[model samples]
Target: MFLSEPKTLTTSRGTFSYREGGSGAPVVMIHGWPESSYCWEHLGRHLKQGLRVIAPDLRGLGDSERTEGQEHYRKQELAKDVISMLDELGIEKFQLVGHDWGGIVAQEVALAIPDQIRKMVIMNIALINNLKGNMEVIEKVRSGSGKAYWYQHFQQAPGLAEAMIPGAEETWLRFFLQGWSNDIPEDSIAEYVRMYRIPGTPGAGANYYRAFADDAKRWGTLSDHVWKIPSLYIYGNKDRVIIPEYLNHIEDCFEEIRVEEVDAGHFLQEEKPEEVAGHMNGFFETD
Candidate 1:
């Protein structure tokens, strides 16, 4: 149950920051938008004994270098960051786990380096291509009833997300604590806010959405690539941002896939860590 403070490593793209902890087989955890590596703190500590967990703040979030260019926010760009982080640590192979935007990054990483990953665990996310094709999410967005959550697009608007959400870090910290999980520990919330409050955090965080929009628009209608790696799909049945139907055709894109549902929301790991970890151990133990 230990975490290395954020450290910087130079990559082909730019200087990236990440945290490492635990021991044994490498397991890199990438967090979604508006979150730092802190999102995996609980699960990382629990899995530390047999798994070396490395959590990195994506390009614009946490302490990672956030430079100009929406290109830096592309999903593939984040995947490159993961590869570069592994290379910096001299790790040739590992497992991957990601949530939200991090889940999107995990998908691309598994595709970009299929041979390097042993297994991939995606939480509360469908494939980017599948998500694009999901009519439910589109209908929700079109209905305008999603304005409260889909306000992500508004957050991407220049200077608005940061401005509207006063004490942006604390605002989001409290938001997720209350919105995503039912039993968020007090100390964890403190740590979560610490990273979220860092400088340049807002724009870098919001860049995730900007890249998501571009990727969805550009790659729309393109069939997704199938990867041979063993994969696990865990989604919260109550997740509002992503409908469960998005995961329906996901098996068509992966050679080996298993799906599990939990009685939680978008932040399943936080809400049900023990259940999530139990399933993860059971699935990863499979031959």
Candidate 2:
């Protein structure tokens, strides 16, 4: 039986809804913005054949409780939610995988408890410091030279996003789902729309962007921090949201890292689950 059923855990911060399946070593999978643990269903099914898989809806997203303040959505606090969830489950160690915004949270979780994470895989995101200060990256985003992350700027506009997004949530979300991938299943898109339409979800999603500056500051302060565990970064060559060029900055952040480029877009796992799962399996099996 694939353990994709929803399960909830009450942590000190709030209740977190997650899915658990398989029966071997644990693998915690985290989803990014505009998505939930449901995004990992395909990948989880693939991994659950040989490893335990846990996919959680981050606080205020999916089925998780909507946190009280925007501060609760900060990357550090989000990372804490994952840590606390594991502690409550009595899981002391596990492998980690995160995509997009989840990739950022995974970095914080690994950094917070390096000893507990056996290995990590970050997909479709550039984990680097001084994001705001990186003029080159800023120029790429601002100039629309390669990939323009216009949503990052728009979401940071406080009350504006909440005002404009709710009524047209499906339209707004389809823009990302279609724009970022070569192909995504219609059912997956519908699922995301249904979940985001839940009350308080739009504001909760926007809070992630609202806390960008603080996230940048935290990464900036940890600029010299080097990742001790083995890490793998998978990038989609056609990812319009996060271009392949961003990988240029990731080399210094990890002590030992390997990069692989796939022929997909931002949502590579969905676009190419077998390939993504193959890479993950090979990477995780290594010493």
Candidate 3:
């Protein structure tokens, strides 16, 4: 994504495509839904000089091969694909960065191998399981999310969101990209539109939302688990769906957390790349 060609690796799950750039401590960057590794293009440029940016197109999203089954979209299952890919790539341990769905998957990866990640940075999304039994947070998020997360319900299970994507691909894609952010990257958006034009890609994207139930249940088993890893969370204060209130009780889940709230929308990195990268570089200690 950062002026590097996309590389392919075959795993049991499917053929995954990723971009690798720079050389130093490895930093795996995971992108969120409706956008591929290309979304990291801007942010990766700044850190690539001092860090190895490994940005993978989540299965069925970018240049990666789409695997069958709705279960594949579940964040835990997606995390497995990432771990296996890293193992095969011969990366022992590394830092992590994730946005949107990637943020959720990054949590799964951290939880699965707390010892492997030197530091973790997550943006835009909140890990709900961390909230556990806090009724106030639980109630607030449920009501607030109901209005914001209406698309989740539409995309989950025999949802109609994917059906709408086939003919009006750009319309559906931009619905989130343009609406969720104050500034939209035209190049990245054009690339995303081209990718979604592929047959079956829309369904693959929708399946991610379809696995909400499975993701919740999987994280439920770790309802009491709290990560002690020094972590940084980048919050987009103006996010329409994942409102700022999600920031409440976040400290309860992490032993040490540094939250940087940006005056942007859900796609904070895209809206404010230079500033976002600055926050990340400072937290990650990269000059």
Candidate 4:
């Protein structure tokens, strides 16, 4: 039986899918790339005991309707989707939590509409401010067997999408799920794969990275925004995709920043859900 109700929302652009539960101050949870709102199933169950949780699958992922065009993959454009979702739901202000690419969207959302966000908890990603000078990490991951992590570079090339369509979902899912969790039930993988198979999703996922350069140029020097609200940053000590060191400068960016390193990997929420949830709840309880 499901712990929450999965709802489909009609936004200005398309139909977005989300799972919501609990009943308190609103807390919006955004899932990261190659994953869906289901990523927060476990964490949201814990959070729901005290707070209302809305976990949404961004466009092209999970039950959300898939769309064509590279413009949909841009962070700025993606952030607008969240804004529209909030407006559609009649939520004026709420707390935010996001992981991976979803974290990037959360940052942009905070920057674009600070009035709508009361506080934020980010897991497994550095602030857009930290994206500055991260090309070295990009090149490093792209250099060796890690080339798969940089698949977006290839997807950006003409005809690569057609080349990747076959078995792309399974291959990518297996690549990221390694050691993410020993307890991930069989159904979880099935749920992820179901969404992964959605038409045009593979291209949309890769396009997120393909458009990174453009996003960097458009939101240059994040120091101006510097996250003024209360914030918490949680990272997996073993996260291979996004190095933990890049977050070194985050303290200087947010005035009331709290940072914690957990003993897990890139999929921290899955690898160490209890720890991450505990830290998140404690932080949210604070003023």
lDDT for residue 203 in candidate 2, whole number 0-100: 84
What value does the lDDT take at residue 236 in candidate 4?
Answer: 85
Estimate every model's Cα lDDT from 0 to 1: 0.76, 0.82, 0.82, 0.76
Candidate 2 regions exceeding 4 Å error are 1-3, 129-135, 142-147
* Cα lDDT of model 1 by residue, 104-217, tens digit: 899888767878889989998657656444656667567777654655767678777657554766866687566765776666677767766766666667777767777676
Worst-scoring 10-residue span by lDDT in model 1: 128-137
State residue 40's C-alpha deviation in candidate 1, in Å.
Answer: 1.6
lDDT of 3 by residue, 108-225 (tens): 8887888999899999886745654434555876665466667777777483755676888888888899999977789989989988988889888888988887877776676577
Cα error, residue 71 of model 1, in Å, equals 2.5
Worst 10-residue lDDT window, candidate 3: 128-137
Q: After superposition, how far is residue 220 of candidate 3 from its true place, in Å?
A: 2.3
lDDT agreement of model 4 with the native: 0.76
After aligning candidate 4 to the native by TM-score, how far in Å is the CA of 104 from where it should be? 0.2
